[model samples]
Target: MNGGVLRVKHHLVGGFSTVTLCPKVTDHVREEIKAFLLNKANAKAALQMQQPAFDYDEEVEEPRPSQPNLKKRKGPMDKFVAPTPPDVLKGRKDRKDIFGVCDKEERDNACRAIAKWFYDAAIPFNAANYDSFKEALELVGRYGSGFKPPSMYELRVPFLIKEVEEVENQLVEHKTEWAAKGCSIMSDGWRDSVVQKDIINFLVNSPKGSVFIKSVDVSEAVKDANLLFSMLDRMVDEVGEANVVQVVTDNASNYVKAGKFISV
Candidate 1:
């Protein structure tokens, strides 16, 4: 200390301990500080000496068996351990695919492949959440390896045509059910601003299922009694007069007036 006042020097104080300053301790502290500065200067000199003045190939040491290092430096990756997976089927819910028998790497790769397809093909994220999407993947898995997917042409043309035919076949069955059980011709009318039109949806519902017959844009349609009668008459004729047990429509003045004219 200068002038008997304690002037705390950070560098000099490095070698001090919790002991109060005394004549004997002060001398020992001074020697400790001297040793600390000397060691630091020697370390700086050794570092400079180890670095090369010019860039050169590093020395290749002889290959030796690696020994475990107790003083090894650790980072996030070095100490990382895979977390234990949860029991999916432990509670009320069914088992999840994440905890399936397949390797985690394999599952991740397959999921990545599907995700890439979505990105590349511009498919929506909601498509993955669809039940059909799960069913499709399960079907492909059941088919095993070497499964060739349908081409764009098949999806748009021949296969689509077959699908249309199948729908028509289902319609024929619906028609049969309508005839046997007698169906109701239901009509719902609304003004759609999107299409800028007054629309009416015609549905033929039976015990099997409801079938959408057609949507008529009645925005500019003639609201006269004869025209309304003709429309209702046509609808009844399409469903077959005998099969149509009831004709349900909105109680609009024009429709009510037209219904009185319908003999059925």
Candidate 2:
């Protein structure tokens, strides 16, 4: 190492092994040995290179065929041909004559149609202004034929009762399920801001979910505990007394007593 002879010897004495160094390495000899090892490792690495064995798959299993790529296409359409022109626009008189909407019979039909739309859409009956609806129809009559709108009496009185009957039928369908799953009754008292009236709401809760039973107007007798209890008891009877497990109400003293009365 660096022009000095280096020797290493192993000795055995008294069954113990010892290593002896000759011309113990100096700093120059240590640096030379490190450089020689570094160069030898680089030469060994440069002698060989690795390549992926592509045929290894064949040794494992047969090769699969490559799939062809397919793409979606709209395909060719027939060459464009011009279409026939439509009939000319009709004047107001011509439209009235053709559709016959100006006739008295047609006018009544139009009024019924408008009324049905209001009912099915659940538009507020009392809040609606019949004059406003008539004015709107008059505006539509400019391009079309004029129509007579129905009176509020026709829309509210009859349609309201029809809506009630339909809702009752639906609740009847769910009554059996509610009884099977059991239900809770909740009573709440509050003031109706718009009507300026006291109201008590009753609701039924079952595994199927909650359904509103009814709202009682109690502005006159709201503070009467006996009357409140009777109203709630009526609801219990309606829902089937056997189906109700608990009655819930607000912390108000009257409602608290009402709950106790129902529980008993």
Candidate whose lDDT is highest = 1
RMSD of each: 29.2, 34.5
Ten contiguous residues with the weakest lDDT in model 2: 59-68
TM-score of every candidate relative to the true structure: 0.52, 0.40
Stretches of candidate 1 above 4 Å error? 1-134, 223-226
User: Backbone collision count in every prediction?
Assistant: 0, 0
| Predicted candidate 1 versus true structure: per-residue lDDT over 21-116, tens digit per residue | 243436467556545544443454345445623223321111101111112232354222221111111221343454455555666898999999
User: Which lDDT value does model 2 have at 19?
Assistant: 26
Worst 10 residues of 1 by lDDT: 60-69
Query: What would the per-residue lDDT of candidate 2 be over residues 207-256, giving only the tens digit for each residue?
Result: 77788988988887647778888888888898889988888888988888
lDDT of 1 at 120: 100
lDDT of all predictions: 0.63, 0.57
